[model samples]
Target: MPREISLCDIKGLVGSELGVSAWFTVDQSMVDSFADATNDHQFIHVDPERAAAETSYGGTIAHGFLTLSLLSAMNFDCLPRVREQQMGINYGFEKVRFMTPVKTGSRVRGRFTMAEARFRGPSMVMTTYAVTVEIENERKPALTARWMTLIQFDPKDRPSET
Candidate 1:
């Protein structure tokens, strides 16, 4: 479950470590499903036998985007929720770097650090997080990204004297 925090508490959290998410396994079935969904049926990602013979990964690997897409679930599992937030939008990433291929059957999880938080207007706040998706037993992370999200809430919910 995500920790709950008030809107007024967001700015205070800037530059702090948010939390690490529960580990998620990236298996062959999941890679195949993602390949089918995105029409990205490249051999390296869908064919374990061929991948082992042809690639340095030694087995099928998950797509970088597939790994990136896990951020939402990872965030939900670890990041704090604003008590007054009615909705949140994936405002997109400032940067993303896929540093390592996540091999099939590997476990991965997200490590998040709050980089910045600022009110966008009376009803919205924008936050930036420095995220790294770490692979179990691996020295290098699967990916690193600077993610941004826009949180929406009623202006009336804003703490008074703002």
Candidate 2:
């Protein structure tokens, strides 16, 4: 069974390995959809024939941002939730780098590590996760990023001042 953890539990678990999701495939269709959505119809992303003929990657590659966006799905699958918090927001990314190409029709998985956890009054500022999405069968990672999320807990729900 998977672990069920709350928001407070995460705060106490700073500098620990959070979780990692099972591998997911990046198919050509998905890559094409991302390219259409972003208007980035570069041959490397959408044109399979052109990509095969020209790029050293030897096939269509996924967009870097597309791989970055997978962090959310990976987080949902791997990270334990904060039941008390009504919602969590994607504050921003501290840093992001494309370490290697994610070729279409390849599988990738993300590994998350809890970097820092701090409280800002009622809000929990989590400087979490150097997320590394590794391409299956490839030593080089497809993407890496430092992502942050803010979880807000209601003051009224807290233990009374005593």
Candidate 3:
């Protein structure tokens, strides 16, 4: 379940951990589907047999983008939702580093920290999260990124100036 946060309080929570998502398995079928959707049928991602022989991973691995794209669902699973916001948009990532390959059948989840939050306008707030995607039983994380999101709300909902 997503936690609820008042838009007025977001800035106060900077540098705090928002939440951690539940584990999600990245299996071959999902990888294959992602490959089909994105046309990234590289052997390391789609061909288990060949990948086992050719790569150090021992089997097919998920594409870096596929793993990165899981952030949307993970966000919904663990991040807080702004109580007064009508919608939120992906503003994109400032930085992304794929440190470890996510092998097929690996379970991964996201850990989010509120790195920064500032009001862009009366109706919009720009938030940056320091994110880490951890693979189960792995010493190193699959990836780390600085993600940005734009939250839009009614201007009338803004708190009165003191």
Candidate 4:
């Protein structure tokens, strides 16, 4: 688990590794739910029998976006709260690649490293994470993303808001 960190702590370690999230499993239920939400009922993602017979993956697999969505929960698990900041926004992503299939029943976790952090006046623009979602027992990663976040804070407290 990552230690609880304030905005100040992040500033001090601007170009350093920050944290990693605990492992989370991708099961059939999750896949089914994602399929329902996205209306992507591709056999490889939702139909186990057809996938087993037709696809190289051997069974139902998770949708790529489903795997990407894991970032939200994963980040929450890994990143400590910025007490002084009112909120943080999902600024954008620099790069995102899905390297391998995430088969149903496999476990995945994210490892985050801070790439860069810059103060944009009252707000901090942080290109902070190179998140790799690794599959348990698999050689390749399920997804890799360079994610950015904007942390907004009060200027009056800048000195104390590291």
Candidate 5:
């Protein structure tokens, strides 16, 4: 479960492992959808038969971006939730590494640790998390990234347009 903490408390939570997310299965449909969305229809990602006969993985695999996109779901499951949070948005990734291919029909989960958190304004908190996407039953993780989220404490506390 996600931890409930105030915006003021985020500074103290840096370097702490928040929690692990529930496993999410990546099926062929998901891979196909991702391929359609990204216009990447590589044989290794969308063609199961050719993948089985030609590739060492022996099956279709999900795109690295597809796996990376699951970060939002993972954060909801096992990260700190700021109390009185009005809204939140992804800031961007500082770093990303696709370590292993995630084969279709495999399950993956994320491990999250607070990397840094700071107050950007009176009602805005900027938090960064070191996230590892682990493949079920696999020795190496599928991907790792530095994920950032901008948490807004109030609806009107947004950046001014100059």
Candidate 6:
């Protein structure tokens, strides 16, 4: 089930584990599609045989950015939602480190920790999540990032300051 909470209460969650998302498969087809979409046809990402012979990774690997992009879908499953919110949008990333290659056919999931949360305005909340994209059963994670999001709350739900 989805985690539900009031936007006003989110600030209290800083420094706590938010949640972990469900595992997602990173198949070669998806890798090829991402390559087509982004035009990042690097051999390691789109060419299997050549990648196997050329790189240490052994076979085609998912692009680093592809793993990064999956964070959004993972967030949908595990991130908390405001009771009266319009929507949340990507604010930016503080940092991102690709520590391991996610080979094609690997499964990945994101573990999220609430890094920080604060009121941006009367009805806007800004939150940062320390996220790790883990490759299934791998000692090293695919990537780690500090991602920020802007949540727009309904004006009626805004808390009044004392």
| Local distance difference test, candidate 5 | 0.87
lDDT string for model 3 (1-162, tens) is 247888778888899999999999999999999999999899899889999999898999999999999999999999988999898999999999999999999999999999998887688889999999999999999999999999999998875650
TM-score-wise, the better of 3 and 6 is 3
Better of 2 and 3 by TM-score: 3
- Give a tens-digit lDDT track for model 2, residues 40-106: 9988888888899998988899999999999889888888777677778898999999999899999
Model 4: ten consecutive residues of lowest lDDT: 153-162
Worst 10 residues of 1 by lDDT: 153-162
* TM-score of model number 5: 0.91
Query: Cα miss at 83, model 5 (Å)?
Result: 0.9
- Models 1 onward score TM values of 0.96, 0.91, 0.96, 0.91, 0.91, 0.95
What is the per-residue lDDT of model 6 for residues 72-120, given as tens digits with 9 covering 90 to 100?
A: 9999988777788898889999999999999999999999999988787
lDDT of 2 at 1: 18
Off by over 4 Å in 5: 155-162
Name the regions of candidate 6 deviating beyond 4 angstroms: none
lDDT of 2: 0.81
What's the distance in Å from true for residue 1, model 5?
Answer: 6.5
TM accuracy, model 2: 0.91
Indicate whether candidate 1 or candidate 5 has the larger TM-score: 1
The lDDT values for all models are 0.93, 0.81, 0.93, 0.83, 0.87, 0.90
Instruction: Return the lDDT, model 6, position 135.
Output: 98
**Full candidate order by lDDT, most accurate first:** 1, 3, 6, 5, 4, 2
